[model samples]
Target: MKKSISITLCAALLALSGCSQNTSSDALSSDISSAASESQSTASQEESSGSSLQNGNGGFKVEGTKLLDANGKEFIMRGINHAHTWYLDEDTTAIKAIAETGSNVVRVVCSDGEQWTKDTENMLETVINLCIDNEMIAVVEVHDATGKDDKTALDKATDYWIEMKNALIGKEQYVILNIANEWTGGWNGELWRDGYTESIPKLREAGIKNTILVDAAGWGQYAKSIGDYGKEVFDSDPDKNTMFAVHMYGTAGKNSSVIEKNLKYAIDNGLCVIVGEFGYTHTDGDVDEAFIMKYCQENGIGYIGWSWKGNSGGVEYLDIANSWDGSVLSADWGENLVNGENGIKQTSVKCSVFTKE
Candidate 1:
């Protein structure tokens, strides 16, 4: 994904775009209990009107294509991606503002101590808490894995998560561990499978029970990666609680057929799949955002538009919102994503985890 020409002038065109590895088991257990307790006081009030009281596992589980809570109620993700790592200045109100847009989920970008500033354990706590406070499902991803062909970057991401296991100990229901964003190094299926198979056990062993989300290779645009080996990766998890994510842009999501095939291959096989990030137009190609939103809503698949703001390079047109506060939205990308016919506001259902009583 090379940068387009300096999009600085695109405005004229119309842009819119853990406790550590060594902590004792008992101590970890206690921390999990306390964190769960701390959030419940507020969580109970945030539940969806039809959602049941969430307790063990806080109600997030996968059944076919749907993400069901403890009550077996569906929680479809209709939300936007936030590049928090790249725009730290917006951290103060990103979550709050994202929630205000009627998003039931927020994919927060973070560095895994490799390509960008390391997100420490404390920072993870604050970020996750912010998501909960705003009643949105937090999908945390390590951005360092982008275009990485070498498994080293993937391993490093795993290690980073293990180190921050403390913050994730008991937040299974409120957060999803997106192992790495587009770990698309060479499109090697072996690396993707072996990487997750090896790392997932480490997380489950560490008591990080959050539903693990593994991105498809090929810069996350290759949906076949999941269709080809999604089951193995899903079963590899000791908890059998893993989901596959696909990032669609011009290459893979240019039309309705491509979109349906990619998503259906995974869902047809009885696995949970989600479109991790996508845009109406990209430096790579023109994305069929309309088909994406329409199909996902009709089929029960979760979808998050590729970002609120801070899009640089030549792809400034990808930004869904005009500013950090999200007060202004772009004509095509931003407006279509949040307010269009099949947009988030029209299709998203708040997760029972955040609103169930």
Candidate 2:
């Protein structure tokens, strides 16, 4: 009987593992408690800041099959993922701090099930506002429950994305929609592909022609998943404005080579690529950060930090910087955001790197 129960538990674990890890739907760490309340108001502010970049009218119209900036210069994402921005419910201050790093893009994430609220639309607008207010770009991530049941999951996903599309149309420059965060489908390409394909027509119908990035299966750490994804995207004939995203964390037993390879694949395949999430907390991790940043900068790829606040499995909160327990944040895999400057030294950068600077 005990053996049967153990087998059942393991099977359940395997079943749950197929969903995206970022959408765990688990309780957030304590740090997010106070921050949750403010995230929603700020979330709506995603592109709210871009309006300020406007000319005589309401900012420049940003219509691009590909992402080219106002000057037609290339704009790539080199930024941090604001943790609990949706959970804590507040942290426009962190957005301001991110701008100091010479970064204009931020991956703003909300914990699971937060999007069902009408208030989410308002929050998204506000967050977009703050991002643009800080002259920063926002990569909006609705990292939420990806059901184990494929048909139901895909249908439910379509519903959620349609809502986001409705709220995000007409806004330009300050926001890009990342469909799901850290897909850990455990090799279920069918589910990922279906979810992505369904979203394109719906989003387009809603007038959201902006760049939409889709993540891969396998905890977002697998590179080969890109090949399958690339195939599916081609098969589905998705809107030309599609990109591929991957998340990475080095110390969490991830393979970095896959990241580099997948990034190349996405770029070579005529799709924009983004390291939607990464965190840097170690000294040596600086080198990796520099390489990825420089490569992405040169190649038009994008990246954002794992988080801004002090959540575990993420970089330390701004107050702690790259140190945990008063020590360096360690050689953990995702240690780039807190220290990715790559020996580029300046007061603002220094301030961003150490949190206390």
Top-scoring candidate (TM-score): 1
lDDT of 1 by residue, 40-128 (tens): 74466456433434323554666556666655577778898888887777876667778887899999888887767889898888888
- In order of appearance, the predictions have TM-scores of 0.84, 0.65
Q: In angstroms, how far off is 313's CA in candidate 1?
A: 1.0
- Per-residue lDDT of model 2, residues 148-262, tens digit only: 3244544454566677665566664456766656444455666666666766667667666555666655555444556557656644534455667765444211234444665
Q: Which stretches of candidate 2 lie over 4 Å from their true place?
A: 1-66, 111-119, 146-151, 164-166, 234-238, 251-256, 280-291, 313-357
Q: What local distance difference test score does each model get?
A: 0.76, 0.49
Least accurate 10 contiguous residues by lDDT in model 2: 1-10
User: RMSD, model 1, all Cα superposed?
Assistant: 10.7
| lDDT, model 1, position 100 | 82
- The alpha-carbon lDDT assigned to residue 263 of candidate 2 equals 71
- lDDT value, residue 106 of candidate 1: 92
Please give the TM-score that candidate 1 achieves against the real structure.
0.84
